[model samples]
Target: MDEVVNAIADPVRREILALLRERPRTVSDIASRFTISRPAISRHLRVLRESGLVHDELVGRQRLYTLDTAPLTGLAEWITFLRSPAGWQHRLDALETEVRRTSRERSTTPDSTAPKENTA
Candidate 1:
């Protein structure tokens, strides 16, 4: 999970993942899309592969890289959990409780600026 997060942290690697999501492509094919050198792209691919976010296969002397979404399932799950009603409700409830507690405390506390009653 850490590896996947680290790998996708880079802009180039995210773009590479997007490309692979569309379809598998050879190293040269991916390299041609960007101004960066093939070696740079290769290094990015290596990171993606090591992270288990992508897989490669050699065909006709060309290595084709493809997206492997299994590793991404954890990330997706985390995102879904964050977006769920329960998650927001928990946070909102905590906030509401704090607000109510503060309001109560303020009401109970006397205002020091209030005018005092004079006894003739």
Candidate 2:
């Protein structure tokens, strides 16, 4: 999941993914639309492949790349969970994650204690 997130972090890589999303394209087909060198685009494609967001197949002499959206399912669900505002429980969970991250960074244990049960 981190890999997928990191892969999409770059605008150039995001554009490559968008191109592949439409249809499978060869490296040249993808590189033609960008100002970067073909080698640079190939490097971006390698990152996408490692992240499981893209798949490459050898068709004759051409290597075709296609988008694989399966890896994005978990990411999409997490985004949806974070975006929901109707559930206090959902918001609390998100807050807990942020708090724990902060606590870990500061090496403090403010949240080490268990959360009190809500009986209201």
Scored by lDDT, the top model is 1
TM-score of 1: 0.69
Give candidate 2's total backbone clashes.
0
TM-score of each: 0.69, 0.71
Please report how far candidate 1 places residue 96 from its true position, in Å.
Answer: 14
lDDT (10s digit) by residue, model 2, range 79-111: 997777766877898999999998788686455
**CA lDDT scores, all candidates in order:** 0.94, 0.93
Q: Write the per-residue lDDT of candidate 1 for residues 1-120, one digit (tens) a residue.
A: 789999999999999999999999999999999999999999999999999999999999999999999998998899988787685688998999999999999899998899999988
Q: How many times do residue backbones clash in model 1? A: 0
Query: Which stretch of 10 consecutive residues in model 1 shows the poorest summed lDDT?
Result: 81-90
List the lowest-lDDT window of 10 residues for candidate 2: 105-114
Clashes of each: 0, 0
